[model samples]
Structures are given as C-alpha cells and as structure tokens.
Target: SLVKTGTGELTLSGDNTYSGGTTISDGTLIAASVNALGSGDIDNSGVLKVGEGELKNTLFGSGSLVKTGTGVLTLSGDNTYSGGTTISDGTL
Candidate 1:
C-alpha cells in the first residue's frame, strides 16, 4: 500500500498487491503494469498516466485519468471510478 503526496514521479512497473487506495495529491502516478492500481479507490487530483498494460482495477473518487507515453494502454475491468478518463495525448 502506498500514497504519493509529493512533487515527484511514481511508476508502477510490476504487479502490485496493495489493497490500499492510490492517492495522488501533488505528484504523478504512472501505471506501467496491468495490475498497478490494485484493489481500492483512486483519489487523484494531480496527474496520472497509463504508460502501458491494462488498468484493470476498480477506481473511485473524482479524478481524471490521463493516458500518456510511448505505448498502448488498455484500460479494462470492472472500473467503478467516479472521476473519468481522458486521453490528453495517447491511446486508451
């Protein structure tokens, strides 16, 4: 379980088994793996990007997910996130 609350960059490149929610208060959370989000809600008001793999996790809160980087991101699964999805500059 982890929470990003600083002016830094976080990249998820492996299968995360954390049940805690991912909160990006003032930084970047990158989803580089399919199971990066884990089992929890997402409260992101800063920045989030899907570099690769599928964000196959149920999302929560009112934050937008922006896809970026140099690969295809497949967002699948029973997503219950309240924010929404946006392709600022990439494929979803």
Candidate 2:
C-alpha cells in the first residue's frame, strides 16, 4: 500500500513489487521504479525522493529508513547496492 495524504504525486514502472511498508505522511512525492523482495520504508515528516530508480532485491528496515524535516533525500541509480541495507539511524 502506497498512501500520500496531501499534495500527491506517485509513479511506479515495470518490474515493480512492494509487499508492505511504504508510507509518506505529509507532503508526499514519489517517482518510482521499485523492485522489492520484501521490505521498504520511507517515513517522512516532510520529503522523500528517489528519482532514476532501481532498488533491486530489497529489504530495508532496522532504523526504518528515515528522513525528517527540511527534508530532501535523493538516491541516483547505477547498480545501486544496499545488500539488505539497514539504516538504523545509528549511521549506516
């Protein structure tokens, strides 16, 4: 489930799979090419952005992949590796 409450724009292209855990609570914009094997989370009090996308064979949790306030987070793509990327907010 992908839910954006206000000021919304969302897009997902081919080979896209998200089983659970994608949320943008306030002021949301997601332009997507997401391939999920299990878990993915973007918890924002403001903004979360990933353009030019390929998040392959994914599982991300731990600190739950967070960005808070005055927020602009962008990940550009070319063989992007997170190896089951765990961002625990302890600094990955």
Candidate 3:
C-alpha cells in the first residue's frame, strides 16, 4: 500500500499481507505489527510511528528503511531489516 504525499496517516493493526511495499512521501505512517509495513523495505520521506509489536522482515531478504522527520520514530523489533538505515532526521 502507498500513503501519497499529503497530510494523512496510515494505521496498521492485526496480521496483514500486501507485499507491494509502502512509501510515505509526505505524511505519517504508523506500524502496529511486526509485519505491518510488510516484508519489503520502507521508503519513508515522512514520519513512521511504531506503536505496538515489531516491524520485521525475512532473513532471506533483509528489511530496509529510510526515515526523514523530526518526530519520534521507533523500531522495537527483533529487526532483521538489515538493508541499512539512512536517517537524515529523527530517531530510528
């Protein structure tokens, strides 16, 4: 799923499977599940909030992230998303 560039927020809860990948270009995207952000790398140029659970990816294909915001963002996962994090601003 995609959160288009604007003033919107995407909230995810419970188990989900939409592996097309997520891209936040101009808003907030909240992940409440380990798989909430899917098994793909998140290309976030906005805010990402992890409220509960973890955001993880398969070992076979390591997860990745890109963060850019001043808001507090946390990844409390037993994260295998090892594609490397590039944070221009905010916390990982």
TM-score between candidate 3 and the true structure = 0.52
lDDT of 3: 0.55
Q: Write the per-residue lDDT of candidate 1 for residues 29-91, one digit (tens) a residue.
A: 887755677766666766777766666665555556777766678766566556667776556
Candidate 3 lDDT over 5-87, as tens digits, reads 78787677666677766666766666654456666656656666554334454221233354544645556434443355566
Q: For model 1, which pairs clash?
A: 59-81
Model 2 ranges off by over 4 Å: 1-6, 17-20, 27-92
TM-score against truth, every candidate:
0.67, 0.20, 0.52
User: How much lDDT does each candidate structure score?
Assistant: 0.70, 0.38, 0.55
Candidate 2 TM-score over all chains jointly: 0.20
- Looking at candidate 2, what is the lDDT of residue 54? 36
Q: Tens digit of lDDT per residue, candidate 2, span 1-92?
A: 56556766444434445556555555644443333212455444434434333333232322123322232333432322222322222221
**Candidate 1 overall Cα lDDT vs. reference?**
0.70
* Candidate 1: segments with Cα more than 4 A from true spot: 58-64, 69-71, 74-90
Per-residue error for 44 in candidate 3, Å, reads: 0.5
